[model samples]
Target: MGRMIVSVQKSILVGEVSAPASKSYTHRAVFAAALGDGKCCLSNCLISEDTRSTMKACRLFGGSFEEISDKIYVSGFGKRLKVPDEIVDVGNSGTTLRFMTALSALCGSEITLLGDASLQKRPNTPLLETLQKMGARAYSKNNNGCAPLVVEGKIKPGIYSIDGSVSSQFISALLLVCPLLDGPTELSIHGELKSKPYVDITMDVAKAAGIEILEQIEQTDPTDPTDPTDQNKNSVSAKTGGKISYKIKGNQAYHLENYTVPGDFSSVSYVLAAAAMISGSDVDVKNLFPSAQGDLAIIHILKEMGADISWDKKEGTVHVSNSGKTLTGICVDAGEIPDLVPTLAVLGTFSEGRMEIKNAGHVRFKETDRLHAMATELSKMGAEIIETADGLIISGKGGAGLFGANLCGWDDHRIVMALFVAGLMTGGTTIDTAESVRISYPRFFEDMKKIGANAIEK
Candidate 1:
């Protein structure tokens, strides 16, 4: 049976909390280590369910690891990429599937990849098109472009262009496999790339791996958008579209013997948001990686909504102090920064004015239909929420007390966690699904308890 739980009524107390490991970094490290020639140490890795899924994929790709305490020592066959005897499972990890697909393409091996039920239902048509176009033999046995992908490796690559608007995971997939391209690989992207910070993180990791790319852009104005996929050879000409090209040469190597994963800003957001909403206390979270993660911008969103927040870069901590004053809702665009949408929406319900979040249609295709789920769940807690194609519009009663509600988690980690935050401010009993949160932050309830939220684990 699916599990559901409750949050005890109480305001969260403010205090200093250490940041969690970066899931983004942990995913990157897994891919990077799989390509490395020898043993390397991975420290500070977030030992979450998502990270475990990534590690499982790495194990199938000729990578071996030994975990001593909280650290991992990974040894990859490097050039000798292993072919699994059977299907390689990615679980619910999208990053694992995308990156592993591209890597398998380079190895010239026959690899069958599958994922969890939710992942199998995801629309990966764009990514499949790119991989197949780049000369990787890709076909689905079941739903096309979904999961259960079959790749005949040793791709004959030329110039490949991918749309940045689709999950940036596809872009990172190509970039990670660029080193194994047949020749100088050129990639062009068109349109306004959602989650530019994720691209930055990819490039950052690539640069550290001693791989350099020459970026070419058709023009700088993304508002005058162009689909990057329109530029590929045999690419469907979209009548009118421009492309930004990037080229990476072969025979490249990124040999890092040691890498430390930073604390996750996405996970840390919960504790910080709890501090402001429940206790109205000022707190600092330490060990966050400012250089990576697109979701770290939540601090700015919270600060704009009148939360007292600051960054201590030198000390590696984020100081968040509530004004002990009223919070007013503000209109914002959350498309590029979708993960932070839940936190902002939760905060919006406690504000004086209404909050409008536009340009986040992609939220519908996440682990669950987040926009509808969030609107429905928040409404159960007495929030006036409007569901739109683009995003959610929340009108708050300015931190007024809320009554109880039975909330659906929608099997989305962010959705469940956000409802938990909503419970803190509502001063009411909230029953939420627990299975959804296990998809990402598995220890969410324990983490919340450490910070003094009144929670009952079932």
Candidate 2:
């Protein structure tokens, strides 16, 4: 595919647009539906490359999917999965690779999971160790922590403890498979859990599928400072001092039901940031559920940065407009909001002071190292940004003074979309690997055009 070159002449975005459905929720919902005892319908599902990978894995496990209009009707596997005739490839989706790994362990046959180049680089050792501790044989082909995992099926569920700081997907993977196990399962997280909201999404999806999960958060007494685990826990400083435990009752069955996915706050952040940066711009994003998504913290972050942004929780909408006003920078703790960092970094270029993004070290494990990508790419456009071990510190001077340049998307969907927003502020920006946006938001450029952004794909 050829590179997409985005050029913009002016900055005046105005209109109402509906946000796409949540990709995170869609992955969990599809997996849940596939494990259900009967047919289930998923409404407002995201038909993207990443979600398609998860659907493909479901089909390999004996689940069938039929698309009727915008909803997907799923005929479940009923917790009895079949060994795939070939290796299951998850493409670039980390969720698919991780969730399918645990699911494969429940079968009595061997299964191998593979992924694209980016996904292959992602660490899976923590999950493999957890599975091994639960009486399943799982190991990487290269003997490394990364992908190309082989699982000799037959899992015995019991107590399993894992480190939480690496990625919450490990815990969610275990949770997704525990309910289908032959025995009860207890998961104890030994360190600070980053992206805790994604785990909440997993629990919420499990509950919707008729599985009950009990969770407990216990903090350590600060006076007893003798534990080495407590010192390591400080890496995720945003979380409390103690481990969080999740208990799942096994031999449980999933019940099929009609499910509706909420609008994605992560995808909507780009549009909201575009409207906030431009002068005399007003954009309303519809179908957002603030309480359900952790990325809704973007609204609060924008408000703190002096952007004119407001949300009507009852109406399920957010209205953003700057009316020719400039934005100011503010410090943001991004522990639970890693997905918002890229868009926020773009918006920070248009603010008046330094913008600090902290406690988001986990972003490095995404499809690409977002902190390094944003810091390097944005700097090429004349914005001063510092990359720290945990986050970024950007010196904001507003978009009017910023200049555009040729950039690379690092083959990351969020990076491509965030750079497109930057293009609107300053024209003549060309982004290679721009098609990566299809992974999550296939209609991203179209949606931006609806709001009067001068964005063109060439």
Candidate 3:
């Protein structure tokens, strides 16, 4: 693909669209299968640039994968990884770089991993420090806590601690490797664990691969009845800034017969938002069965914004239409739902009041400074959005809709897609870095066009 450029104009969308497979689940499932003891088949895996990086990394670690009819058959090395002949290039996939770095500890020799410029800027000090504490020689080659990381093998199992205020990927990276260690491992998380739902996804996938992880939540205030230990208590301790501990037995073998990835709520948020923002648009996004995805909060966010949307959990479908209701703004705590911020920001453009997004500073650490990207790009289209230190404060136009202008995608998939959604509400919008959509949903423009979106590559 060349430097992709697209022009989008306002149009009424009306149709059913299938949500893409979950990229988060696809990454975890593929890694789990690659570490399994036997053959595993994964269905509905998201075939995208980021996930393809994970697949390539898995292959370097002695896993064999064959794709056939939307499914991948993987033959895992079962804790016995081969020292790769070349340096692992994760190619813009932070998850791949982190998870594969942890897995490299099992290799008999040293394994070095690196990524593109955007990914190299992401901090990995928390993960590197944790791995070193766990008896592995892991460090950033540049000594800047960012990538071009190197690790030497045979890490012994023991208790390890990592600061969780940064990316949750550090915690997740350790979760994927500790189960196969030679001895039981106790992992402790300190400080606020940003994006905890992502850790939940990792645990869910590990359990599906026949690995058991015992989780315990230590309340800052023990008197609080909403501790996760209590099955009846469904509230989160994230607001209180609690600690989490995980216990995993050693010498565990991963085994998966068949695993099917779920529909991606993160990717479909743009689709659902388009239907909700435009009048006379009725859209259904299918295959979105609920799991541990934090971005599933989009449906609740939409409903809270007064959008006429309904989600049928049984059928795994989300329906969105105008319904003659005035969409208003609401304060959103984006601590658990960082990925939805861009979509929420665009939705705020069409609302009747102000939408405040908070507790999302971690989003700055993604492939790009998403907070800055959204604020800058949306501002070009005349959106009154304030770029806060941690989040965005979007003041709705009160039906004085924005006019289209030149936008930048920042070479980040989510940023590109969110801007595309904004483009639909304001005609004559031109966006660069349009090719970045291949990182997640390669068919986004095509699918949107099927539902009557006036978008085209020029």
- Winner by lDDT: 3
lDDT of 3 by residue, 1-458 (tens): 58888899988899988999999999999999998868999999999999999999999879999988679899998867788999999999999999988988877578889999999999999998888887789999999988899999567898878888898998998998888888999998886788888999999999988899998877665544322222232224544436789999999999987999999999999999889888889998899897999888888888877788898999999999985556788877777778888898888877888888877799999989999999999888888999999989989974475888988889988998998888888789989989999998988999999999999886
Clashing pairs in 1: 20-263, 20-264, 108-153, 108-154, 190-228
Clashes of 2: 2
List residue ranges in candidate 1 displaced over 4 A. 1-4, 222-243
**Candidate number that wins on TM-score, 1 or 3:** 3
Per residue, candidate 2 scores C-alpha lDDT tens digits across 1-458 of: 56665555555899999999999999999999999869999999888999999999989989999876658889998867777899999999999999999998888678999999999889988899988888889999999888899999577878889988889899998898898887788999976688888998999999988898998767664443222112233333324555689999999998858999889999999999989988889899998876456788788878877789989988989999988788888777677778998998998877888888877799999999999999999999999899999989999876646787989999999998998888888877878788899999989988888889776677
lDDT for residue 273 in candidate 1, whole number 0-100: 73
Model 2, which residues run further than 4 Å from truth? 1-3, 221-241
Ranking by TM-score: 3, 2, 1
> Model 1 — TM-score against the truth?
0.91
Worst 10 residues of 1 by lDDT: 228-237
Best by TM-score: 3
How does each model score on TM-score?
A: 0.91, 0.95, 0.95
CA RMSD (A), model 3 = 3.0
